[model samples]
Target: MDEINSVKIEFLSRSRNESFARTAVACFAAQLDPTLDELGDIKTAVSEAVTNCIVHAYPDSLGRISVKARLFGDSSLEIAVRDWGRGIEDIGAARAPMFTTGGDERSGMGFSIMESFMDKLRVRSKPGRGTTVTMTRRIASRADAR
Candidate 1:
């Protein structure tokens, strides 16, 4: 897809930053003129991706997380959340519904939720390096909705 606009942000992998990341992405996506439901889906997917970085990627200590968002000419938005901490050993298992390494406190539905809400989802990681989750959603133009 041809890129229309893009933004990248880096922040500490703290629980508090999850909301910041979510809102930032939502704001960047505003130019697409998304509906409330579309905005909510983007925010939720961002929250899950950032939360996973804070809770799972760096369980022992704080780490760096990066989020990059891009807009395409087709009105599609792509968001990538990355963490520079411990990476997942099994990407397949992580994406499975109800599979969680977060113990009892987590429901392990983050990936599944992201997949359901976005048009495309991709997860990449190296066991000792880090993990990156990229998701895209297409915003229906106002005319198309009518």
Candidate 2:
């Protein structure tokens, strides 16, 4: 597929930056003319991804998190959230629903929520290295919108 547009942003893995990541991706996805539902899904997925990085990846300290968003000609929006922190030891367990390592405070639905909201979701991680989550959602092209 050919790339239409792309943007990359790097920030500290902080709770506050989760909203920033969501808004930034939403703004970039705006060019695709996604509907309110699509926009909300994108934002929610981004928030979950960023929140996972802040809460799980850098559990004890701040680390670098990078978010890269891309727009494709097919009206599909792709967002990748990456972190340089303690990576998941078992991706299978991490992606499982309701399997949270973050004590009782967390519900462990981050990956599940992202998978539900996006058309496609991919997660990559290595212990002591980092983790990256990539998600894509296709916006329905409305004939009347153009």
By TM-score, the best candidate is 1
Q: Please report the TM-score between candidate 2 and the true structure.
A: 0.96
RMSD of each: 0.6, 1.5
Tens-digit lDDT string for candidate 1 (81-143): 999899999999999999998899999999999999999999999988999999999999999
| Residue 26 error, candidate 1, Å | 0.5
Q: Write the per-residue lDDT of candidate 2 for residues 27-116, one digit (tens) a residue.
A: 999998888988999999999999999999999999999999999988888899999899999999999999998999999898899999
Model 2: residues >4 Å from true position, as ranges? 144-146
- Quick one: how many clashes does candidate 2 have? 0
For every model shown, the clashing-pair count is 0, 0
Per-model lDDT: 0.95, 0.92
